[model samples]
Target: MKTIYYLFGLVVMAVLTLVSCESKPSLQKYFVEKSQSNEFMAFDLGTDIIKAAGSDNLSADQEKALKAVRKLNILIFKSDSTDTNVVHYKEETTKVKSILKNGDYEELMRVGSGKEGASINMLGENDDIDEFVVFLRKDGVFGLIRVLGDEMTPTDVLTIMQLVEKSGVDMAQLQPALNQINGNKG
Candidate 1:
């Protein structure tokens, strides 16, 4: 009886190990792999940068939301239908869709469609949100923004977005980088 019980326990452990190992790949890993090849433009912003970008005019809720955020990762891919690398664009879009669908992510909201598409998604376990993902495809550009936060709620995300829109940060600072990605001279 003891031998049988021990063998059953071992089998259960092996099954659990295999199941954990087979879990879907993280979105962060996918972003890093695609950005490392120089085919995509990537930006990583730590908490300090995010905090500094916010103004003193932030509301209590907005301030709390910002404090919960640990980091932000942005990846952009510019593709034109007439471009030779359009095939690569299609592959990337497909890969992103598959990853989101297969992973634990849940679609929070979706806006626009076809060429002008955008969506917001979240990856969470229990009541804690681990990451927030935003994918926007407009014109010939594809952009992904991943916000890593702790104990984030839906209200917190809304406040964060509101703060971002109201923040006086100058987006023109990114014009040079955007132009480079779009094959335009600054």
Candidate 2:
């Protein structure tokens, strides 16, 4: 009787293990895991970073947009096109592509070929997008950016990002990572 019970318990454990491992993965989960790896660069920026650009000069609409956004998550796998780097870039970028394509995200734009490309996707229905995702791949670099918010319209995001172009946003937290990725370019 004891042996039979032990065998039954073992079978149950095996099934549970397989089931847990078989669950579908998500882009958010990928970010959480890879952000810790030394091979990748991660930045979790809150609304303050955007406000830093020029909060005092912001229009009413811009302020509303800024408040709607909760945070931005950026993950980058930078490479210089070595054989090992090529392999890592392909693997990580492919995983991200799979997650975005297969998940609930709706593609807003996609440009480029197998070797290089950029894609924009959003989650949520028309005029009420909650998250906007952009992934870009160049010859020696790949990056993912997630703009998470609550009930943000497309226009709102555009308004806030325009502030970044004016060049007042702080890059202190991103300087090191930016240095690593762009250092060899020029």
Candidate 3:
């Protein structure tokens, strides 16, 4: 009887493990893999975004929204020249698009076609959001911004966008990518 009970416990544990394991490709896995390559530049804007994003002249709601954010994962594609860079840019862009389109994320907004466009996607329920993803593709360059938090509300995300639109994200963090993109354009 003891042996039978132990076997049953083991069986239940195995079943639970199998059920919890993720089988499909995930955006996070892609981020890790691409970050190692020379073609991509990755940055983590830590929890202290108030400092990084420049908290000057922000409203109460904006400040609150910014505080709700935990961190941001940014991945920008880099190339030496626009003429020669289309190969990897398109490839990585396609991978990101595929992940977002097929994954369980909900789309907030999308515009443009394959050559140039932008998209915003979110994961989790309406009230308790887990992560927000923003993808931008233009001028033969592309970038992915993953906003990670514990339980950000939809209003928080909207206010954050408003804050960014009004004040813009800290340019220091994005300067390198901007420079690289400009250089590639020529």
**Predicted candidate 2, C-alpha RMSD:** 5.8
Model 2 ranges off by over 4 Å? 1-22, 51-54, 183-186
Tens-digit lDDT track of model 3 for 27-61: 89988988898778787887554342445766787
Provide the lDDT at 20 for model 3.
88
Name the lDDT value of residue 162 in candidate 3.
72
After superposition, which runs of candidate 3 have C-alpha atoms over 4 Å from their true positions? Answer: 51-64, 79-85, 165-168, 184-186
Each candidate's root-mean-square deviation in Å?
3.4, 5.8, 3.3
**lDDT tens string, model 2, 1-186?**
999999999999999999888668898899999989977888888877753444587778888888889999999888766899888888888899899989999999999988789999999986888899999888778889999999899898888778776646677766766876885432
- lDDT agreement with native, every candidate: 0.77, 0.85, 0.81
Clashes of 2: 0
Candidate 3 structure, TM-score to reference: 0.83
Best by lDDT: 2
- Using TM-score as the measure, which candidate wins? 3
Structural similarity to truth (TM-score) of each candidate: 0.78, 0.79, 0.83
